[model samples]
Target: MTMKISIERLGPRRMATLAVATLALFNAGCMVGPDYHRPQVRVPATYSELPGWTQAEPNASAPKGNWWTAFNDPLIDELEPLVVVSNQTVRADYANYQEALAEVRAAHASLFPTIGATGSATRERAGSGSVSSAGTLVNSAAARVVNSGSLEGNVSWAPDLWGQVRRTVEENAATAQSSEATLANATLSEQVALATAIIELRTTDANIDLLEKTVDAYQHYLDVVTEQDRAGTIAPSDVITARSQLNTAKSDLIALGVARAQYAHAIAVLVGKNPEELEVAHSAAMPALPSVPVGVPSTLLERRPDIAAAERKMAAQNAAIGVAVSAYYPEISLSGAAGFTQSPLSGLLKIANYVWSLGGSASETLFDGGLRSADVDAAKAAYDATVANYRGTVLGAFQNVEDDLSGLRILAEQADVLDAAVRDADRGAEIAFNEYQAGTVDYTTVATAQATQLSTRQTALNVQESRLLHAASLFGDLGGGWSTDELHDPRHPAAPAAAAAGSVQGGATSAGSGEEKVQ
Candidate 1:
């Protein structure tokens, strides 16, 4: 007589309860490594270069578009928008931002389980004389055909036992924010470059106008000298001198075209057009230097996109440290599979043909020869490098603002002195010409005075151009009116949802959190 033993299998409800308990235990585990805290950076209370500067009152009614519109050129207003839509460099950066956002979504997805399904069918014929495992042979005439099929569904999940998944998501989200800032930087840079090129192109037009007038004046003098030579009152050498001045002025006027053409070509490329396909008509009117609003130096960190990008990169690298630290812990994964199988199609739907499994696994690098330790060290060093880069970027932003301010100030002073010199030179030339016409002085005196006047006027034109160029530079250095807030807005389609959420956190902590305030 033999004793019978029985065991009960868990029902679906009991299996589900067990799964929930396991998940709760996994969720309760503490995450490894440090939480991110932004590194401290020192910012000046006030800008040294802004001693006499006053902040412009916020204009609620100002056009909420391209910052270059402050220059008040209709052409620039029309062209600046094209940089966002068409500039190749900006488009590439936008694509990069999109890719970064996709990466963030991918990382976030890792926090949940993946589910899949599979099915297969096969047909087979047993050999005529096949032997059985028990040493039984099949007759050649008794061969049989067999058909088999199976269907399966599976699930796999590696829970964030030590916050590896969360850390990765954080890292990718920060990287997406950085990419968004980079796109903004690229757009602003292209707009600034286009604005500067337009300013130079307009200045070239002004110079060309000045030279044409000088050339006409020289021609007039040449004709007068020729008449005097015919009357035997002035030497033929005077006629030669006047002709030489006329040709020289003409040559200078022609050379101006080279720079003007190049600037036009650059503008075309910036606006996504071929060089030959775009043309800026000649305009003698120069754009006045607009008054730029330079806020406090502390604001530069939030105002400059490049600085913002560097800061976000530091945050991403900080998250990466947590990801690296998580590697020291075991990776626990949960997997489940359910399927159906039958040797013949007629029995495939029977309950007896069903199969199922639920299981889990844990893996640890018990002996990695210090590889995990090296990874953690490398991650820390990378974070340190990003911190250094962020600080350097902040310092460089201040330097740019100061440099542009000083340059504009000196240029304004030089313009004043040059204005006076131009007036004196003009008067002298007028007097010399009157004397020559009255036969009180030689043509040489008149030629010398006219040449001096031309040089002085050209110098004044150059100073004006410098002032415009410097103003454009200052606008760029001041972040082209971009705020860090723009990096997170959903209305700006380039921004990813992850970036927007992270930026919200950044903004909340920016003022009162006592974590390094990036303005």
Candidate 2:
């Protein structure tokens, strides 16, 4: 008689039940670690500078979801969407975010059992010399085949007993969120760059047109002076001066073309194309600056992608501190394996031959020469560093909004002055031409008036371009219309209201006299 022993402790059904119960228990509580809370940062209630700008009540209107669309430039709206999808920097950031997401998934997977299926087949024959029990003279040995197949599973869950897994998940999630914010920021930047480049390119084209017309006028004046000299009405020296002025004006026109080409090339690169392949033949006219509405200062926290990214990083680092601290606790793991085996292939399916194993493990680092403690200290230090960095980012964001607002406001005023200068110059040029036509003024006076008028007009156009660029900066710093909802993932800190308020205070110095149109 043979004593039969059942080695399989857990049946397939039992193993499945255990796995489900374990998962339920593991998931039964709030994730361990310090939940993030936004620390207080000083921010002013209103902007102090309202210099020259008529102050108005703060507009509580949320930023237009697509702030650039507020510019009402059809081209801008058409191009910005592509920037988020195809721009290289945004693509790279998106990839990083996916990677972080993968890490979180991997970490989450560790909380469950690992299952596997295994099979093996083997053939064996005994040698005559090795077969002591068989006939010594046996030259042939019987061949035997053994086949086995088993299904098994193992579980090793380091219970968040100390919250290590939770903290790690928190950290990874924050990193993933940060990557998302960074991607948004990168996309916003690309869109702004393209918008600004197009504006500058158009401005260049306008300048070239103005310079060409001025060159033509100068050439006409040169011809008149040459004819007068031939008739002995003007000296040869006067004719020479007229010719030199015409040549200089033509040279300026050529220089303007070079600048235009450069701006075109820049725009081409922004739109993801080679300079030679681009054909932006927009000769219509320079775009008008858009009217920008400043919302409450507190809105800055929700609108800026950079600030959101920084805050996410802070959240990640905060979780890291918990991860470091969790190292001090014991780690618990539950493991189990179940399968079937038999000497005969037919017996493999029999319950009697089934085999299984189950176990639990607990461990803690007994000694590491204070290394773990040092790591905890280092993580805490890193958390502090991130806090400081987050605060600095918020401060810088406020400063940027203020700077752009001041710049745009002042540029708007300057444009008004430049408009007057252009008008005066045009009148002077007209008067000079009339005098020349009457034979009272020399060709030199006509040339001077033409050059001055053209220069003033070009300057005015350049200022208009500057105003548009400053507006772009203002829009960008204000967060490209990203909302606080986008910035706040419930897993992280609340909106930084003080920072937003500070931004408004810093930006609010100048108000519109009475809703004057920017265009």
Best by TM-score: 1
Candidate 1 lDDT, 83-193, residue by residue in tens: 776777876887788788788778877877799999989899866677778988757668778888998899998988898888887788788889898988887788889
Q: lDDT for every model?
A: 0.80, 0.70
Clashing pairs in 2: 46-505, 47-505, 49-509, 50-509, 50-510, 51-509, 53-511, 54-511, 297-500, 298-500
What TM-score against the true fold does each predicted structure earn? 0.87, 0.84
- Where model 2 places Cα greater than 4 Å from the true spot, the runs are 1-19, 27-33, 49-65, 126-136, 139-151, 433-447, 487-519
